[model samples]
Target: MNPTLHSWLERRRDWLGLAVLCAVIFVVMPLAFDVFRLNLIGKYLSYAFVAVGLVLCWGYGGILSLGQGVFFGLGGYCMAMFLKLEASDPVSTKIQSTPGIPDFMDWNQLTALPLFWEPFRHFGFAVVAVVLVPTLLALLIGIAMFKRRVGDVYFSIVTQAIAAILSILIIGQQGWTGGVNGITDLKTLLGWDIRTDSAKLILYFVTAGLLVGCIVLGRFILRSKLGRLLMAMRDKEERVRFSGYDVASFKVFVFCVAAAMSAIGGAMFTLQVGFMSPSFVGIVPSIEMVIYAAVGGRLSLLGAVYGTLLVNFGKTYFSESFPQLWLFLMGGLFIAVVMYFPNGLAGLYDSHGRKWIARLLQGRRAAAKPAPGAAAQG
Candidate 1:
């Protein structure tokens, strides 16, 4: 076995590095950046959950799911609906309320409220739906697709279609689903006023904590036997099947996991951004998630985190600085990274670090050589 593998197999060395990194982030973020920028950084970290999920689903499982945005939207919409209902409530005793007594009642002028939106007015129901809705949808879809033996390009295309169709449907429903505008003006989350800076800061810290938790949990999962089975299914489904393992169940499990994580990321994002829209979840964002994994080296966990940060940070800074050339710059960056360094940014980091350390060691050895022929003379 390789030396690295030999060391990793029996030791928990990965936790040391992760613990150090988390400690550094928690300490430095508060000191270095102002609250505003730190909050933005936290926003970036919220989506890190999506990165974690993609790392497992794409890197280990060899599954490039292109509809994570749909799962994300599911989570965001669930929360958004509840927040909107609570904000729209007319200070009443009703368990639930909508503007038009819901579709079933079909009241004119909406003097009452929509009944369909009743359940979401409560925080508990909202949270549950945000999780369950996406997970269930993913489970159902995964069963259908994996059972049919979908793979490669076809799997990607089908997922893309799911996202695209959902976006179109949301856009078409102008009255009920907020249409293109989406749910907005979120006044609070869990009874805390969202407009206050302190609340935003709290949200930021929460997002950071969630990102760290997800990364650790995902790392644990990736190191388990299930992770190995997913990889086996990815590499050779026929061989796995021949070995008597049911491949479809593994795929479904991974897909559902990815979906649940994406949904949670969406919920976190919506909370931070204070809104949700059809634009937030669709084909483009879904494709972007895949690109993030690919460009980050899908095989490496750290690469996924680094890849997402690098890609999205560029999008943020470049777009703000050069609105016209941002897309061109991103496209060029992606192509250059893919063509020249297929292993992504993490690989680049490790390779360069090794070279530097090697050079330093060589310098030390030269300094210690001691007049080359002294030993020979002795």
Candidate 2:
């Protein structure tokens, strides 16, 4: 162990300050904004979920995935189906609602509810499907691609195409999936009135809980043996393979974890916003997730949390002021970050940088001082 390096690393900063800041925000922000602000922040936390997974794949695994939005929406739609099924009033209020079916199914001229939709009637099953489906897909994709050594630009293109296709398919399935209009006007979730403030708070708490748990979980994973193996693979895959490790299996495991995280984010999003649309799950949104991860500081998990908040805040501010140009503005922001900060925000506080800076300063001071032997002899 290098004493100089250890000293610098230990002197820099502890997680204590960050921990206190989190406590303060969670406690103080709710008081300032009533239920509306709290709920909105909760929705933002779901975006943090996407950032977390991006940090894992892009940050540690060196895999650039631009289709997290597809997984997110998959989970969302699954949860939406259950909520819609449990929603007696939404079904009844629908102009075309029949004796036992929801409005959309009847309006689409469907004689009976699809058997696929039957499992969603049970919230537990829907929740499990929401998580597992995306995970399994990620597993299969990661196994095939990693085993074949297809990565970098090719991988990005394939994943981006996946997101685009999923969005288009959802929009085209008007009869079964509600198409472009999306599943909206939701009324209740698990017998709780969706419109009530209490329900909103519950959803908000759920999102907060998930975000905290994920942060802890991500940090734990990064510190564990598996996390070390992932970093090694990212830095040099062929070397790791020669060292007797199964590279494909490691990649697939991380990929599945990332997909499940994105799905959880999506499910929480549906619960909060009361809607799920094709537009939200498109290629653009997936790229935006990558941008958020990059901007937030990929190396540090906490970077994702703040990156989502900052980017979303920018979107809200710019969209309100320049509705027609917000997309361009966002693109510009992304370009600016990539051009200026290659490693993203996390690079700013990296251990190596901090240690180097300290070393440079110490060297300059030492060079300026008189020699110890000369002074003693004098």
Candidate 3:
């Protein structure tokens, strides 16, 4: 029985790690933090989704996309469009020059609704778009890049360029998008007052639950044969192709999946934060998203969550108190993490923390052992 339990621990330690993470996020955090702080954690957890996606796409699959924010923004904008439509119902916008259209559109002097936003009036379509739009965009991008054998630093550059293009387009087309200000003034979701404390608590729970689901999905992928193939492709793409696997297909799959995860986070961000912006869709936030993944231990899904929370919390605290020093501190933190803990926080825990845990368990096992004669009699 002891051996069986030990073997189980050896085989499924990652599951135990995930369970502990989920417990902290769902239980301990809610108990420890006030409503406002809890809500802030939820907002940070939204980026955790993107970081986890990066684990699968960049860490394991060797696809470093610098433009994950594009998917994040796309998903967010989809949700924002729906909420904006609901908020701009004729009665609410009666005083506007053009009632029933978004105020930004009115401010920009647009007389009619944009063709693209028409589909978001329905809640179901908006929800679907949150996932589908990002997935489709990623699929197209992946096909274009991967099919032609473009990858590594070049792929990263292309994605960055794509982010820049989207940000410029959104800002330039003020009548369609919200311009530099992006989308704002989002109020409700399916008649629920999203601004209320109770609603914020509920939304935090929803985000936590969804995040758990994504973690489970990532774990399943990582443990599967496809995951092995991804690692192999990452290390030796030519060898993987020589082995008759469709390397491009695997790359495309991981990229699209990552985009979907980021999109879901973006949608939730819109719900929790009450807005979407090109600022998040631009190169800076996108790279910061990568930093979140790197700091979390790119290979560890749970690490991503903790890393994002820690980094963002620090950013908030320092930017408020020592704004000028924040950037330098952030740079130093990144360098320290990379140089000393290449695998991020999770790697540190795995290397040192797990050794201590193993020693303690072994000591307990030794102490629990019965006398030789007594064991024979039993």
Candidate 4:
């Protein structure tokens, strides 16, 4: 085949993979599952947003951040704050001493809303903050770390420390962050009750749509000149730096993009799950998010989504069936993936599945062709 044609075919295959994933999320899953299960999948998909970000930051840019949960939590909290305020209207909270303040704030003897929380009263601000807050924080971290040439395991450790610190701060500030419980009682968005079944169904599609958008955006990045530069920097950072390129800037940009993506996921999670907590903004969940990327083939964006769904499904099934062994089971699964399938599911497909698909297509083409010399006989 001509090189140009082969490249075009490869591009089509990539798009085809995305189309299949869309079908699973939008068409098949909705048709196959009930509302409750669909909502659960929505929650899983929210986590997938983080996994997708990891593919770019870790898989492509070679930036392994173990504190993505902090960004996720920040985005979740930003949205949760807005929702909590909406639900804290005077009529609803009339029983509390401070009817206009959140219930937790009232319980903590706060007579007025904090200055920081006041801005969240507007839904638009919360939406903007969801993406902006995390990205800005990532920018700061990136500049401080990348400019100093801190990376590899050191960067990962620093991210984990940040996650731990953020978790403690949120839990310590009960009045402001809902304390250990994080943020809860998120009931509505712009007076629309999010608790209803119909609302959940809609939210699931919204999450799915946003997830697809993120994947598309990620694919665009990976196809651009910057994408090639990221891979170059990842593999040969010193060489790229010496070649007149600003290596630190590229790293900072990708890290911030990953942060923004994770934040979007966090915001969606708050909307779909109806709560946000310190548990999600900590070390454990951050590590698990990385595992999702690893299991899905960090090099493959769509694989990240599938990896998250498969792992979470296993978690749910095992926890319900053999609660005592679920942790071990999950651990074993991760170990197996790392040991036997280092490239993850996407790697498996590339090695074997793609070959089988190609053969099948070839066979069909051969069968479609007319017998040799048949036209001459006619």
Candidate 5:
């Protein structure tokens, strides 16, 4: 093999893996699964958004965020607020005492839409908020933490606390946020009914496309000089600072990016799952998202997607058959992942899968050449 070809393959190997992932999710899965299962995959892909973000923030920058679900919930609630408002139009909510407020609000005896929910009445604003809101929140948290040079387990604890607080606030403010039930009864998007099978297929494709786009974005970021700096900062913060890099800014930037990505996923979740609730915004779900990233191999963006799907699939499978033992099994799986495969699934593939492929290629080349004296006989 030419040296340049080998170098190129080594550099572009992750890209090739990403391409294969896109093909499997977009082409193979759609053709293989029925509509119901395909929709489930779409929900799973939504979680992939957060996992991919974690690959950057945690895997590269060494920033572990346990409150990712806060961003996800923010994004979902933004979209949900918009859709809920649309569904609660005068005609639709004519039966309610407050003919234009959301059904839940009306049920709670509220006479008007909250001021915060007013902006989401515009579809465009809601779309922008999906990305901006979470990023902004992350920026604030990142600045506060990184500026003080807080890190590691302390940062994780702060994030988890945020998730818990947000969940409690949402549940407590029942009139504004639909309380424990969450913002449900979402029916349409810009007047197109989202409940139909055809609509579900379109939403699935959209979610898959967004996820692939994020992976490409992650690849670009990881391949750049900034990405190298992030890795360096991860390993040696003092060294990066001595080199004159703004370590805090990078940390904040990566955190915001991760928040934005998770937000997009949350918004898509609302669209596909037909609701947004505190159930997804709480500590347990936030930690579960982290587990998805961990199981997938935090260093591999594509692995995150696969990890989210596999973990969720296992949960559903085991919970249905052995509900009592599901938690124990999940806990054990996490332990094994930590102890045996610290680098996650992607690390395993890189260590073993690439070597296997190389061996196969070498064997093919050897077989193509004339063995020993066979050419002389000919």
Candidate 6:
């Protein structure tokens, strides 16, 4: 085949793969599952945001961040602050000593909303903060570390430390951060009750839509010059740097992009689950997000989403059926994936599935073609 034709065919295949994923999320799953299960899937999809970001950061950029939950939590908390504030209107909290403050604040003996919480009352500001706060933090961390030449395991350790510190900070500040329980009972978004089944369904679609958008954006990035540069930097950072490229700048940019994506996931998670807490801001969930990317094939964007759904579904099933054995089972699954299919589900498909598909298509084409005798007669 001509090179141009091959490129077009490859692009067409990618679009087809994406369309199949969309059908599963937007059509098949919703039709098959009840609202409750669909809502759970939405929650699972929320985590896929992190996995997708991991693909760009770790798989392509070669920047492994174990503290992604920090950004995820920040985004969740930003949105939660707005929701919590709306839920704590003066009329709603009239029974509390602090009539216009969060219940946790009132319970903590606060007299008025803290200055920091005051701004979250505005929905517009909260929306911007959801994406901006995490990106800004990532920017700071990236500049500090990348510029200083921090890479490899050292950078990973630093991220893990950040996750631990942020979790502790949230848990320690009960009056403001909702302490160990984090933020709960988020009842409304602009006075539309989010707890309703209808609202949950809407939120699920919204999450799915955003996730699809993110995947597309990831695809675009990977196809661009920047994407090529990222791959180059990942494999040959010093060579690229010596070849007149600013390696640190590329690292920072991709890291910030990853942070923004993870933050969006966190925000959606809060919307779907009706709460945000330190539980998600810690080391464990951050590690789990990495597992999602790892299991999905970090180099494959759509694979990340499938990996997330598969793992979360497995987690739910095993936990409910064999609670005591779920952890061991999960560990075994990870080991199995690493040992058997190191590049993840996408790798498996690339190695075997694509070949099978190609052969099937070839066989069909051959069958549809007229025999030589029939062609001669015609």
Structural similarity to truth (TM-score) of each candidate: 0.86, 0.86, 0.95, 0.97, 0.95, 0.97
Question: Each prediction's Cα lDDT score?
Answer: 0.77, 0.82, 0.93, 0.94, 0.92, 0.94
Residue 324 of candidate 5: its Cα lDDT?
Answer: 94
- lDDT for each residue of candidate 3 in 1-378, tens digit (9 for 90 to 100): 257655877787888898898899889999999999989999999999999999999999999999999999999999999999999999999999999999999999999998888999999999999999999999999999999999999999999999999999999999899999999999999889999999999999999999999999998998899999999999999999998999999999999999999999999999999999999999999999999999999998999998999899988887888888998887888899999999999999888877787778888888999889999999
The C-alpha stretches of model 5 lying farther than 4 A from their native spots are 1-8, 368-378
What lDDT does candidate 3 reach at residue 55? 96
What tens-digit string does per-residue lDDT give for candidate 5 at 1-378? 546546766987887898889899889999999988899899999999999999999999999999999999999999999999999989988999989999999889998888888999999999999999999999999999999999999999999999999999999999999999999989999999998899999999999999999999998998899899999999998999998989999999999999999999999999999999998998899999999999999989999998999898888778888899998887787899889988888888878887787677777877899877887888
Which portions of model 1 show Cα errors greater than 4 Å? 1-13, 91-112, 354-378
Tell me which residue pairs clash in candidate 4. Answer: none
Off by over 4 Å in 4: 1-8, 373-378
Global CA lDDT computed for model 4 = 0.94
lDDT of 2 at 131: 91
After TM-score superposition, what is the CA distance of residue 30 in candidate 2 from its true location, in Å? 1.4
Quote the lDDT for 115 in model 4: 97
Q: What is the lDDT of residue 258 in candidate 4?
A: 92
> How do the residues 123-182 of candidate 1 rate in per-residue lDDT, one tens digit apiece?
999899988999999998898888999877898899999999999998887566777878
TM-score of candidate 1 against the unseen true structure = 0.86
User: Model 2 residue 117 lDDT?
Assistant: 85
Better of 1 and 3 by TM-score: 3
Specify the poorest-scoring 10-residue window by lDDT in model 5: 1-10
Model 4 scores a TM of 0.97
Q: Each candidate: RMSD to true structure? A: 4.8, 5.6, 2.3, 1.6, 1.8, 1.7
